[model samples]
Target: MATTDPLGIAEARSQLGTLVARAVHGHQPTTIRRSTTERAVLISEDDYEELLRARRELEAGHVAEAIAAHDRGERETVTYDDRAALYADLGLPTPGERS
Candidate 1:
């Protein structure tokens, strides 16, 4: 199981790799906090890459196109079962699923 914690700067620096490993194994998100500020996240490489791709697409305005497609019914509505189908179409993994 994944373990998560909010850590101070020193703790984060020391535990970064282990926290990242936990995230990769589908453990709960590890948040590094400094004072009242949230510092960083420990997440899988795949999750990081997915975040990058999504950010890139949003920057390029592809997000608007996807929204438009959904509005126009070109993409099927995201019903419960269709969630995976939608992710599959977008070449993304089901983010919360781990076994």
Candidate 2:
């Protein structure tokens, strides 16, 4: 079974190779901790990219909802002269641009 518990920094450092192998090959994430509140997770590159992609999709959905609300006059309208500038303001890709 995969362990989700956080490992102490020193122990994690000592077993970095095994930790990385578990994350990559076993598709498991390992949390390393310096303290109770200070921690970081290690995952495969594919998992990291998947997380980024999911976040982008979520942000895009939120932006689309806000735009729809503005169009329906449920929210204050903010006009943009340029589409690129509009997406840039939201830190997203333009309508026709590749994501």
Candidate 3:
């Protein structure tokens, strides 16, 4: 079974190889922290991919809802000029502008 306890940065650094072995072969997860702050989590590749898949599903759901709202005319359409101005306001590069 995987341990649920958190490990400090120093300890985790020392036992990184062992922790990685445990996570890969034993399907265990190690939570590494810096002082009292949670820093990173070590998990098996399967778990990491699962997290990515879940995130993608969540984003897809949001997109679908937005599309439905747009079909119902619940959202206002913006012109290209408006989009360019909004992007400039947010300090984001325009479609063709390089960073």
Best by TM-score: 2
RMSD of each: 11.7, 6.0, 6.5
Per-residue lDDT of model 2, residues 49-95, tens digit only? 99888978887797998889889988786689997887787777775
The CA lDDT at 65 in model 3 is: 70
Point out where model 3 deviates above 4 Å. 79-99
Query: What are the per-residue Cα lDDT tens digits for candidate 3 across 58-78?
Result: 656765776687789985655
Q: Summing lDDT over every window of 10 consecutive residues in candidate 3, give the lowest-scoring window.
A: 90-99
Instruction: Report the candidate with higher lDDT, 1 versus 2.
Output: 2
lDDT of 1 by residue, 1-99 (tens): 223456777886887777666778764567777778646666778887887787666544754676788899898765556777866656555557531
In angstroms, the error of model 3 at 26 is: 2.6
lDDT against the true structure, per candidate, is 0.67, 0.84, 0.75
Candidate ranking under TM-score, highest first, comes to 2, 3, 1
Error of 2 at 22 (Å): 0.7
Collision pairs in model 3: none
For model 1, the run of ten residues with the poorest summed lDDT: 90-99
